[model samples]
Target: MEKQIDNHYRYLQQHFSYLIRQQALLPGEKLPSERDIGERFNLTRMTVRQGLQTLEAEGLIYRQNRRGWFVSPPAVVYNPARRQSFIEYVSSQGFEPSTDLIGVTVNPADARMAELMKVDKGARLLFLQRRRSIDGRPVLIEHIYINTALLPGIEKEDMSQSLTHLLRNKYGQAYHSMNLIFKSTALLEDAARELGAAAGLPGLHIERTNYDAAGRVLELDYEYWRHDAVTIQIDVNDA
Candidate 1:
């Protein structure tokens, strides 16, 4: 009985794998309903679901609420050392990119924030939250803290667009240096919620601190990315 059940799921997995490899099920195309697949395969619904879950773990498919599974699209490449903005890189890769400002607020820096920004406690900072998408699929959530003292009246400016552009054109400030840290972990509750993913899903966490020519911290950014949505590539040159 155990061997038979194992073969049952493997049979469905192999069938879908063949279809995907042949391009019969194109990327981003929805799969058939679970009931339909079960009926076609002469398997129980649980067995069909188990097979689909296996493919999802292999990065061959993904599920959306209400909507069924879809063939996974090609992962976007992100190079940490690259100076391109999110829109620039995504567009260069032939993907449509967009940003939605979740919210913005001015708040006093707490102890940890003060330490990170090298500012005194209670220093005013701008908190900005944004959700970024590629090809209409929400993939990243960014929480940014800006040192308001560095750019006077910055809070009055539009916050939805690229900060790099705003700094260069408006404040005459550009990125001088940055420190970045990347971690692979489960997505947190708030970030997962914003990305339309279930809590505790595998994710990529990126923490970046931006500095100006004078070595003052300009912004501290926390980015949560869907695990399957991005592929990070970096080129190192020997000194």
Candidate 2:
């Protein structure tokens, strides 16, 4: 009986990890109760709990007192020198990447937006907003301000797909983005709803200014990421 219990716990842990990696268990989503897991697996509640505890120790999941276990959001690390697309960075972590377009339109530049993108006041600009997911879990929300002077036909673009790919292939543009700043913030009501996160919870806020080959400010973007679901990796060489 003891051996059987140990095996059951191990099996449960393995299966749970698989679900997490496959994104079947989404970030911020509560895991079924131990009793529920046991009922499904035909195991004892203790056995199910052992599996969940292992995941918690690994920082892949968390238990909030009586709130139950949930997938942990990613951690964010700021590296000033790295240049990579958000998709590329996320994919390298062995997760499926997807984006949900929230809003996309061309509009007159506002005072602040104009200053950020270095476009003129009332200049036509493109606004793109999206919610990004990994393994079917919402983790980040991004808003992009693009100067229409550089890319005139943005309204006709199908940005429900990859914006980076579009810029690279269609415009023959190679963009290198620099991180202007990053800070931690609490989720607003709108952001909380989109991410299924609790309102006022901590999130990672990133502000970036992207440049073109001629050092022109191509776009300015803001990204809000789930604090526990992502991490930045960087290696430093002697300078």
Per residue, candidate 2 scores C-alpha lDDT tens digits across 1-239 of 88988888888888888888899988778989888999999988777877887776555776655678887766434354656566776677567788999998889998987888777889888888999988777888888888878876767888777777788888887786464677888767787678776566677788888898777788888888766766655687899
Residue 91 of candidate 2: its Cα lDDT?
A: 76
Off by over 4 Å in 1: 1-3
Give the per-residue lDDT of model 1 (tens digit) for 83-163. Answer: 778888899999999999999999999999999999999999999999999998888999999999999999998888999
The lDDT for every candidate, in the order shown, is 0.90, 0.77
Candidate 1, residue 34: CA error in Å?
A: 1.7
Candidate 1 scores a C-alpha RMSD against the true structure in Å of: 1.8
My TM-score estimates for the predictions, one after another, are 0.92, 0.70
Task: Tell me, by TM-score, which candidate is best.
Answer: 1
